[model samples]
Target: MELELRHLRTVRAIADTGSLTKAAAALGLAQPALSAQLRRIEKALGGSLFERDHTGARATPLGELVLERARVVLPAVSELQAEAVRFANATGALDRFRLGGTHGPLLGGLVDRIAAAHPVAPVSTYTAWSVDEIASMVIDGRLDFALIGACGESPPPLAERLTWEVVGVDPVFVMLPEGHELAGEGELELASLADESWANVPGDGCFEECFATACARAGFAPVSVFETDTASVVHLVQVGRAIGLCRATFPPTPGLVTRPLAGAPLSWRHLVGWHPRSPAASAAAVTVTGATRAAYAEAVSRSPSYARWLTSHPRFGTVA
Candidate 1:
C-alpha cells in the first residue's frame, strides 16, 4: 500500500500519545484497527515504524522523520480544505486575518483601521516583544502577518523570511522626570547625557537594543542601573532612578517629559511583514498596507507628537 493521509495521521497520533491504545481512542478507532493500520504502513515501507516496549509504543528514527513531515503536510492540507470551503460559502469574500505586532502607541490606530475596514471578518492578534518570536510564529503558520522593527541593534539574524514594508516613522525621545535637570532642554543630545544613569528593559525587550545603540552612537556606553521587563518605561523614568528612551508617539504621562534626541540617530521605522506564500498573508498584506497609510494620515492630523515630529523633520515625511 502506498502512503496516504490516514497513514500519516496514525503515525502522528501514535507519536503524540506514546501508546497505541490511547492513539486508537483519540482517533475513534478500535485498537486492533489502529494496530492493523500501523502494521500495514510499516510493511509497505519494509521497516518497523515504532518500537513496542513494556510501557507503550515509541517512535523509531524513521517514525520520527515521518511525523515531522506529517506536521507540515497535515497543516497545509487542512488549510487548503478550509480555504476551499470558505470560498464556496462566501464566493471569494475575505476570511479571517491573523496578525502579530510589537506593543507600541501607533498600534492603537492601526488596529482601529483594520476593525473598521472588516467589521465582520474575524481577526486574531498577538503581541511580540522581540523580533525573533514574531518571525518564528509567522514561519510556523501561527501568524499570517506581523508588524516589526528591523533587527540590528537588538539581535542578529533578523526575521529574514517575511517580506517587509515600512509603514510609519517615529523619533525616539528621552523620558525624564518633570523636575530633572535635563527637562529644561528643548532637544537633548545623547552625548550631553551619557554620564547619567539609565534604566533599561531586559534582553528580549523591543527597545532594549535601540536604547543601547543610541548610547553607543553617542560615543559612550550607558550604565544601566536598573533592568526590568515592565510594559511601561515611563514608570522607571518617573521614579527619578534613570532616564529611558521611548517612541515619540507614546502617550504623555502625568509626571513625565520627553525630548527628541538632537544628535543621535533616534528614529525607528515601523514595518509590516508577512510570509510570501500564505494566501491569508497575501490578503492581510493588501488590507493592512491600505489601512496603515490611512491611519498614518489620521495620526498626523490629530496627534500632536506626530504632527510636530513629521512637520519639522524631512526624513519623517518619507515613511509610508
Candidate 2:
C-alpha cells in the first residue's frame, strides 16, 4: 500500500485516459481491479486523487501534484534502466536472464528449459496480470523478455517496438466442480450454462469482451461474472460458487473438471516478445523464444485432453 512507482504510473494513466475504465484497458487491468487499486492508493496518500463520476475521472489538486512528479520520475527511471542495459552490453556482461510474464505454467516451463540450456545464467522472473506492464518492462530495458497471451488472433502489446513470436494457441475451457451435472459430459455448449455464474482470472486483453460476445452468440447471457485471481477462481469453482474459465491446458485440479466449450467459442494465443533494440534481441532472443515454444509443446503433449483435442482440431495448438 505504500506509495510506489507503479502507483504513480496508475495515477498518470488515469489522468491521461480521463476514465478509469479506459486507463485500466490501457494498463491491461480490469476496471474493478484498477478502481480498487485507486481506492487503496487514495487511502495510503490520505487524499482523493481524482474526482470520479459517470462522466469520467478528473485529477484533483493532489492528483495534479503527484502527476507532475510521476511525469518526471517515470521517464527518468526508464532512461536509467536503458543506460544500465547499455553499460552491461558494452562491458560484455549481459549474461543474466530477466523475464516478465502473466500467471501461467508456460513461464515456469520456459524458465526450466532456459536454465538447462544455460546452467550458469542467473535467471529471474517478474509476474503481473497486465500484459502491458510486462511489455513495458522489456521496452524500458528492465526485463529482457516478455511472455504473454492474447484472445484469439489479437496481437501482443506494442508490436511496433518488439519482436513477437507465437508459442501456441489454446481453446478456452470451463472448470466445473467434479460432481456438477456437466462433469460427465465431454464437451459443453455455451448456452447450456446460461444460468451459471462465471469466474475467471483477470487479463489485460479483449478476453472479457470476447467472452461476453461468445455468450451472446450462444443465445444467453451469464447470470454473473466474477473477475478474481487465479486461486480465487479455482476456489469458487471447487465450492460451486461459480464456474471458472481457463486455458485448455489448465492442469488437473482435484474436485474440479475442465471441459472445452463446444465449437471453441473462445481461444487464447501464447506469445513471447523482446525489444528489438535491446541486447536480449541479439544475445538470446532465439534461445528464449525457442525454449518457450518447446515448453508449450511439452505442456500440450502432457495434457491428454488438449492433445486429443489438438489432433482432431488440427487448426489449433502449436503455432508452427
Candidate 3:
C-alpha cells in the first residue's frame, strides 16, 4: 500500500486522460490492472484519488492537492533515472539533457536548437505554470536549465546559486477585441485601459503582479478575474469582457489584436539559468540565449502585427 513513483505516474496518467481505460491503454496495461493500482494508491494515500463517473475520472479536492505536488515530483524522478542510466553506461558523458520552462516563446526555440546541436543526445521538456516551481527543479538538478520571466531589475532567488543569462527582453502587449474602440489605435497607455477587467492566473510568472502594479501606478486598481482556461481568456477578450496580457510570441488569434502598452508597465526580462553542478552549464546557457533570440525573430515573421510593433520599437519596454 506504499506509494511509489509508479503510483504517482498512475495518478498523472489518469488525471491527464481523465479515464481509467484511456490511462491504462496509454500505459500499456489492462484496465483491470490499472483499476487495481488505483485502489492500492488510494489505500496508501488514505483517500480516493479520483471521483469516477461513467465518462471518466476527475481528481477530488485531496486528489487535486496530490496531483499538483506529483507534477513536480515526477519530473525530478524522471531526471534522476536518466542520470543513473548515463552513469551506468560508463561513458562519463550525458546521453541527453533535461529542461523545465515556464510558459514563453523561448521554450520552443531552445528545444529546436538543442536537437540540432546534440542530435545524439536526447532532450526532454516539462512545462510548468510558474517560474517559482521551475526554480525548484533547477535547484534539485532535475533540470540543467530553466527559462524564467522576471520584471523590473529583479532576478529569481535561485539566480544566486546558478549561472544566469539574460536571453532577451519580451515587451508585454495588451490583447483585446479587434473591433474594440482602442484597438483602432496602434499603441495604448496602460492608464487608458485601467477601467477594463483583467484576465489573469495567479502565480503565472509576473502576470498578476505586473498587472496589479501597473494598475496601481495608473491610479486605478484593476478588477482582476482569475481565468486559467485559454479558451475563456480568448472569449473574454473577443467579447470585451476582459483584456489580457501577452507577448509577441503568441501567434495572432482571430477576433483579437495586440497593442504595445505605452510606458510599458509590465515588461518581463527573459532569463536562462543553469546550476554549476550541471555539466557545461555556462556553455549551455550561452547556446540557449542565442536560441531564444532566434525564436523571437521567427515569431515576428509569423506575426505581422507583432513584427510591426517590434520594428516600431526596437528596444523592449522598460519596467515602470
Give per-model TM-scores.
0.63, 0.73, 0.65
Candidates in order have lDDT scores of: 0.71, 0.89, 0.75
- Give one digit per residue, the lDDT tens place, for model 2 in 1-320: 77899999999999999999999999999999999999999999899999999999999999998899999999899868776765554424448889899997699999999999999999999999999999877876778889999899887898877899988889999999998998999899999999999999898899999999999999988899999999999999999999999998888888899999899989999999987767787859988988999989888877798788888898788886
lDDT string, candidate 1, 1-320, tens digits: 89999889999999999999999999999999998989999999788989998799988888888888999999889768754553443313337667787665556677788788888877778986776788667666666667665433332224445677777666766778998988988788889887778765443544556667777878998865576554446677888877876666556677888788884376666677766655554566778877766665665565476567666686663364
Error of 3 at 46 (Å): 45
Better of 1 and 3 by lDDT: 3
Query: What is the alpha-carbon lDDT of model 1 when measured against the actual structure?
Result: 0.71
Give the distance in Å from residue 185's predicted Cα in candidate 3 to where it truly belongs. Answer: 0.6
RMSD of each: 8.4, 10.3, 11.9
Q: Which runs of model 2 end up more than 4 angstroms from their true locations?
A: 1-93
* Model 3 C-alpha lDDT per residue in residues 12-95, reported as the tens digit of each score: 999999999999999999999999989988988899889999988999998999999999999888768755653343323445
Candidate closer to the true structure by TM-score (higher is better), 2 or 3: 2
The TM-score-based order of candidates, best leading, equals 2, 3, 1
